[model samples]
Target: MSGDLLATDIEAYLDAHEQKDLLRFITCGSVDDGKSTLIGRLLYESKLIFDDQLAALEADSKVSGTQGGDLDLALLVDGLAAEREQGITIDVAYRFFTTDRRKFIVADTPGHEQYTRNMVTGASTADVAVILVDARKGLLTQTRRHSYLVSLLGIKTVVLAVNKMDAVGYDQSVAAAIDADYRQFASGIGLDDVTVIPISALRGDNIIETGPNLSWYDGPTLLEYLETVEPVGAATGGPMRMPVQWVTRPDPSFRGFAGQLVAGSVAPGDAVRVLPGGQTSLVERIVTADGDLDVAVAGQSVTLTLADEIDVSRGDVLAAAAEPPAVADQFETSLVWMSDQPMLPGRPYLLKIGTRTVGVSIAQPKYKINVNTMEHTAARTLELNEIGVCNLNLDRAVPFDPYEVNRDMGGFIIIDRLTDVTLAAGMIHFALRRADNVHWQSVEVHKEARAAQAHQKPCVVWFTGLSGSGKSTIANLLEKRLFADGRRTYLLDGDNVRHGLNKDLGFTEADRVENIRRVAEVSKLMVDAGLIVLVSFISPFRAERRMARALLEEGEFVEVYVDTPLEVAESRDPKGLYRKARRGELVNFTGIDSPYEPPEDPEIRVDTTTMTPDEAADRVLRVLRERAILPSAGG
Candidate 1:
């Protein structure tokens, strides 16, 4: 490959490049496995480096090169200052090159276990994965981890590039031993298609031209293998599916749904169904800026106009009527936790799959896979870079395929509800059987009828504060006052509930989250029964409090903040909790070791230091009367 054609005929070069198809691949392995070096060498051998880049490479190599002052090829792809200084890839670096046979997009992914999420982000779209290994180090933990991930992500083709052969005198036995060991492990992980090649990425041996050093090995060179392989993505010729990304309504007469087709082909007059609703229509036209397409296949972005006006919106899927995808509200999925915050089961998160984002909550993990040993160990929650299998419950049903069937429809990301940060990536295994079997039975009398008969509006009065801050005392007094005024009421104190419902839970952060979640659900049921439910608990985390608030209808959940100083509350430690915590008898105790995030905004705030518990109870009743939650005394 040379630039002689570029210098003489630029248009001819562009035409030649346009005709060739593209192959997206990633280079990944353990740290110091020369992933950047191999990609840099590939770019250099393909003649994709510009003149200025070559000059800079030569100049910068002396200052930061791992090799003794030679033109460090790794410097070409290591673009970050920290990457060059640390001699390891931290972020995914993508580069493009073109050969006569094909064009190529290569991503250099990080190798550290801490950056496994970064590697997953790069490999999610790749058609192939080139896993480099050090000949001297043999196989390491990260090598097995990335290999398992490659298989997990459904990249069927794998190239095991054994790098640094020159460091081992180009020994054929060294490469053979490593390949055999990997194959034995790969068999257990269902990795069937593996091509092993020996090469020195620094010396460009067996990478481009099969240098004479490896005379014993007879395999396709790294570049030759990449140029010939089929670059089919995870989903190709399946049922037609295009998740509507936008509704183009430039004018009322012209309405179309615009999105990229993830599978199969669509044409005008084809009967299509809008999913999760199953509304049938015919494709009126395939619109594009260039012109109208008579037919469009997967991987093409176009606007589709239906034969009839339908309720198609963003987050809805357009699919072939004959082979529509499955719709469900629950699924068993493989989850990769990417955030530093440990996953909390039953906590709400936004699940974004394809173009749709829905409310979802994960259950406790069934098991987490040990990437190195391939063992399934029990785990309560997933930490950063951990993989687990868990069940997820969605707020509503959505159309999807199994991850093995179609990546676009099956893969999804879990996002934090409040912060809007991506916390995990997940793949749907299949719809859970319970989701299909379970249905809400219709009732003759609903919550409104129950409330009307009781002659009052139902709500949950949530009282949250530090321990010994008068939450329980105020709630008890408030319930008695409401009862005397001819109102149905119930009180749920934290300690009393722990004696029965939450006996199994501990004082850890995860247990506290689950405890609040259970109480919140109970309170919701009590509210539906047409009674005023009082909840008094030291719910520490703000996120959990927000979760509880979201479970109720507008104006149905009232938050009362008991504003008592921690020192004052500690001085009146009614249960001796503060003294026990100070003596190291109670770990993860709020106001001492753990955190308590007070509500920034609440419906009512009572400073217990200035008011008595009876006065706080009376204040809550007065606010309730003003808000029309109860009948006013004047009326």
Candidate 2:
């Protein structure tokens, strides 16, 4: 064709595409379930591939094709070199295509167990999930997992495409059996809107056109179903919520809050509330790049100008005043663990919800859901690809709705602070009762008044070291020295406290984290009472120690690292923990089986190889006196 003719054709296509409704869907299932092939066939049959691209695909298929002497339709979607070589999708590959009736955005997600995170990422924004099940293999574990994730992500529509029907000899009984089994399992998990269809993606059966072999099966093809399905929108009728993405100030006279409306609708003269800080204002105008909008519904990007000046900023939510979201610092949530590192309770993470980011910690899990068996098993932590129901405590309260009610307001991602990697995706179930019910009781005698009476500064001397490294001995002597010097002091030794306070805890990483958290809280209370608190524990993890440090005031919480060689500590092992660990009798024993992350920059370091316990105590006391935590010698 001539350039002018091609340009005219492209313009016509763009105009028609602009007018078509769009559907975003995902194809996911177990490995070898033909998800890629089904997508490739859909794109090919729709005539969306250009001639040159088709030629390249044909050539590549001949060189590295899974099927011999035939065009590999799966090559259209599986663009990665590793995917083409291994004949499986390794990452979520997105493609766009259009029919005369509707436009489509399909995410071909990986089917392997290790790429469950990739599947979750794709399903998070999808309105529908097309889970391809192998006809010969039926529904596998990954199919169940992906379906459960789809349900968790609030996707209401599901199409179970039973692929590879040719391998099963186009047997209607096999397809029916698999469909019945999947529907039964899906129904139990509250996935009620599921449509099952049989297809052979390799043979182009029941994809874009009805196959003659499946004459007994009377249903729309996959493409037809996709084009005809109702477009799911955000909960626009419930409440208006737009997280402020930017504070737009293009000129001296104009200022507006810009963001996509995730829920409800906003118009000029609508009453709105700025959340986390309950400031009310009226919407003065809705500005957009296309000029001004009289009204904007959910999913529209617009800048909103408030009638009255308010302290609205990025990370703040603008909501309908009549039906504002809840504000709470604690919530019960379900999280999908995505990282290689297991979720550790009491460890700090950066929790990002909407545009807001805050410090958060995941508490011990209530239970872990087994996707295949649907069993709720007791679990303390979530490993990679595991899903668990847990409680989360945030650094501050923010406005949010339950994920089931409003996805954008309730969904969040946890990021590792040090690595900056996304660790998990979470959906808020509900705010905890304590978040609303708990209130701080005011007291007249504060720490300052008590410190004046005690004639010393309040602080916590945290002593952390390996087992048999003399942490308790040094702390015990240090407390005695402080007491002898006319200063009020209290000693919280690990073993003594474990016998009473932390008796239910074990030696696992999670249990150890909780144990240290309790000790830190108690130490905080003691310091508030204007007593110098000496904490002696083999707190191995730096993250937990940092958590403890964060709970106290600036000058308080002095970290005293007791440095001892592993061989020396093992030789002096009074508890025989090292011996037991060596014999495989004890698991999660720090310095033997478990890891010990020593503090990189402690305030005080005591090497027991050279210094005696009394000398260590004197060094601590000298430092305390030098810092004015206690009075100098004679004074």
Q: TM-scores of all models?
A: 0.97, 0.94
User: What is each predicted model's overall lDDT from 0 to 1?
Assistant: 0.92, 0.90
All models, RMSD in angstroms = 1.6, 2.5
- Compared with the true structure, model 1 gives a TM-score of 0.97
Residues 1-635 of candidate 1 have per-residue lDDT tens digits of 32677789998888877878878999999999899899889889888798999999988999999889998999988899999888989999999888889888899999989999999999999999999999999999999999999989988888999999999999999999999998888888988888999999999999998978998988899999998987444447988999999999999799999999999999999999999899999999999999999999999999999989889999999999999999999999999999999999988889999999999989999999999888999998999999999999999999999998899999999999889999999999999988657779988888889887777789999999999999999999999988988888889999999999999998888889999999999999989898899999999988888899999999999999999999999999999999999999999999999999999999999999999999999999999988888855454
After TM-score superposition, what is the CA distance of residue 58 in candidate 1 from its true location, in Å? 1.1
Error of 2 at 81 (Å): 3.5
Residue-level lDDT of model 2, residues 575-610, one tens digit each, is: 898999999999998898898889999999999999
The reply for model 1, stretches above 4 Å from the true place, is 1-4, 231-235, 632-635
